[model samples]
Target chain A: MSSLKKSFNVRCRDFIHAGEASISVQQLLKQMHIDPVLIRRIAICGYEGEMNVVMHGGDGIYCVEINTDRIVLDISDKGPGIADIAKAMEKGFSTASDEYREMGFGAGMGLPNMKKNADEMIVESEPGCGTRVRMSFIIKQSTPT
Target chain B: MVPEYISFVEKFCTGCSQCVRVCPTKTIRIRNNKAVFFDELCIGCGECTRVCPEGAVSSSISVIEPCMKDKLNVVIVSPVLYAQFPGVMPSDVLIGLNEMGFDHAIDLSYYLEMFQYAVDEFVLENRKSNNAPWPLISPICPVVIRLIVLNYPNLLDHILPLRRPVSLLGDEIREKLSHEHGVDKKDIIIYHITPCHAKVVPDRSGLMDELGFIDRALGINRIYPGLKQKLEQVKELELSLFPNEHFSFVPSTRGPLWGMSGGEIAGMRIDNVIAVSGVKETMAYLEKIEMGLFSDMEYIEFRACTEGCLGGPLTAVDRYMAKSTVQKFIKMFGIGRRLPRHKIRQLYDKGWFFSRIKPSELAGVYKSKRKPLTFDDMKKIEKLMSLIHGSDCGACGAPDCKTFAEDVVTEAADLKACFKMKE
Candidate 1:
């Protein structure tokens, strides 16, 4: 048809099946026959945001929205907010544990890759409050096969 | 070896994505919520069958059952096929093949005598040219040929310039039947009673430029028992197993040994020869041979199995028991007492297994046949490529850049593990 919107509330601290939830979200958008480019954008941002919640967030939720017009993903965590969101967003500046590093989780490129791949990206975090990240993607109808 | 077309049943597919995940060529697409197979790029390895959880993957092997119309079906069995019948006499199996729609059933080693002459001539030419490498690998084994072509392609030029044994034998049979029986060439089906599945992988998947070689494969393991059962109903004519054909190629007491280690070099009189039968040992030899580690050798034979075809997993015999039996047969037949002069010399004139290389052709489906990638499609493909790490580690099982990118674009694979950034 035209455009559709889909949202998902990704549990903040679920580590075991973290990627599984995003996979379903990605597959659902794919089944909807959304534009390949838009689905990719949604997927890249959605996965990064979902992973960021599980890896870096305190206790909050992440949401994903998809449609024919554009796709949007929003994630908020009430963890120790990034005192320096700029530093956190830097490609290699990571605050991750050895376990995260062993699991290939904390290269600090999550925010960067999200920004690089998505058409729009926004992040807001308070020092004591929480962090909320929203990203958007343009529906390049034929972005992928 | 040519592949028979396998029907793609979309409805029966569970969308479990096993085929997509295991296909060596990455030719499957998950489009419109179903897994669609693209035959153009398929190598026909049946990797999809091993991966399918639903057991939905099936081959069109039954397509060869028609016996090539009312025409005479002459089947040539490799000597090692003796291992297929276990305790049964080879003549009994020959009778079985005769009952199984075969007008003529002959052992391939008979034709091999002639085939050996061609290889000898090819080696002579190789030495004269001095441009080719020593110890020219045998093309008799299609799997070894494919491995060289696909993996060790640099050694392609060194392969012996002779038509494969079966193809040569096919040509000779065609000519004789055409002249002797005055049979129209089209009315004859020359089937090589085979053991390995490579015989089933067609000479050309339309992946090559030339016409495909051979008509069909009848793996002895697949059809021999059925024929054996059918032989029970036939008139009990104790037909001669060893036909009145003139003897020329009397190999060692180890006739089936030709299917095993030391079979090729020892039997063919290619002195300074070394042969490895099984896969592991052959690969190890190839490594050194390709690297020029071995020298002063006239020929090298690699069978991809220990003790060669006698020890083939498809063979129904204990290895040592079969070897001893073949030894006994050789001693009883007085095979080692004398050598048969090579009487069949016309094999040198036969043409090679002809096929041209394919480069980024997508099995020749160009813009004329299939639509060209649109700019939008290109951008999408690039987007998917970006999803991949570009390392091209073959983790997703697609070999290189374009293939992996294509898979991602087709939605046959997800982009997460490939490009997901750690938090």
Candidate 2:
């Protein structure tokens, strides 16, 4: 309901401090009195894409924008692009290194989780170039808890 | 304590880890590429502020800048802190504190011994009244009280009626200092050495629009540097190791533990008195309340952090170490149960001590915190939370994205606290 929008920038693919960005977006959605279901979706997808950038892309920037009617997320990477977009979307599929898997990430659930939470998700990648992800969730006016 | 009190400077803040290393509670956090204070975790020990060479970190103070006009400052420290020195007499800290700026210092816990009975009575009366809110929560901790007021308004009535430490002591300080000494209320400002910032913030806010009885709240971390420095330099007077000032004062490990987690509930020896040890545990219990579950408990001691006041952000020692310190101190001097009720009554009957100093303030449930969240609003919040998945991962600048979102919706918080919502 406020005219002003609250915002922050997430550094590309910094695994050590990865989730910090998604947490902020979830809090912003909460301030808008948006539904938890909506927040949860945004979080799942945001986290998914965020991890993807870290593991696959090396380093990338992520951005989130929230409004009463809808929530938008944009994750951009300057690292190597996705070799194959279709192969990456498969459930339980990951190209993450051994280090990433050891940290409980890169079990191939990242893309799936993002797809599950967001109402709309788009991924574009060019080999040797970076990859970008944009996701959106539509907010319902009233939902019973 | 006066020179050692916590002071904050917004400028000259460089993200340095010096203060964090020196902190006893580890309450200082570097979230969102900057320092974020975990209030529930801070004990007002003045350690971090003292260690901050740049003086960028600040805590609430009685006097503001440009007018560091020193006055006849008095302090009222809680009893638990008396456990700090194992060998010294309480008078040593008192004498040392007096030399600092207090000019006069008195123990507020002396009044608390009598008030415990009052608390017991208050709980008993509420238990007998079926109309009272079920699982009546204790109101002794100012931090918990304010947490409820700022975030959980629906459960406001559930708060038990008890005098806060500083408020009760505030009345006594005002009376003893101004009335007895022919000093004006404005002139005789009493600073309460807060265990955490919870007390420090509201005390500065004048809390609930009520005039603050205690002039300022000095945290342990904020004062640690100044006091430690003073102690090092002022070798002239051997710092007294005795913690309890009076022979009547019982400040053994058990006595000090009275303020720790589950201490009050255990003290009451009442049935259904639940003591939530940490924020996560407390939130779970609060969740039980949200499920429409009628908590039939009589007294609940809700601690925001893992260790009780001992784990406060301000203290100069680690909680486990402090607990061990307290344990060793208790073993050295056996002080088990509270002083006899009669003795407490006698102290109360006589003017030598009084308990309820005008019962000035009460902490609210939901809307009382710096940023507030409510039970009814959570449904809307859950909707938002459901969108994010249940991972409370603090990627958001806030402790969690969902909570940050709730705070923002209520206009109690900013979107900057969250990563998911960051632009």
Which candidate has the highest DockQ of all?
2
Looking at model 1 chain B, report the run of 10 residues with the lowest lDDT sum.
B360-369
Q: Model 2, range A72-102, lDDT digits (tens) per residue? A: 7888887788788888889977787898778
Question: Whole-model Cα lDDT per candidate?
Answer: 0.57, 0.57
What is the DockQ score, from 0 to 1, of model 1? 0.01
The DockQ values of the predictions, listed in order, are 0.01, 0.02
- Say which candidate scores most in TM-score: 2
Q: What is the TM-score of chain B in candidate 1?
A: 0.66
**Model 2: lDDT of residue A139:** 66
lDDT of 2 by residue, B1-423 (tens): 111234545456565656555544344544434555655444444556546778677555533212124555677766555555444444455655665655565665455555556556566656677666677766665555544443333345676544554566677667766766686778877676655645645432123222367666666655555555555444566645543343224333444655567766655545677777665566555534432233556767887656777776566667776677666655676544556776655644453332233222333212212332333454556566656554655544344554555655666455555555554
Which lDDT tens digits does candidate 1 get at residues B1-423?
112534455667776666666654355655445666655444444446545666566544433475766786777666776654445565666667667667777656655555565566666666778665766776655545554543344345556655555665666677777787788888877676564544545444223221223456665546756775765654376665554242213323334546656665655655666776655466555544543334457677777545766664344455677677676565565444232443334324433432233322222231111233433444566566665547655444444555666555656555543433221
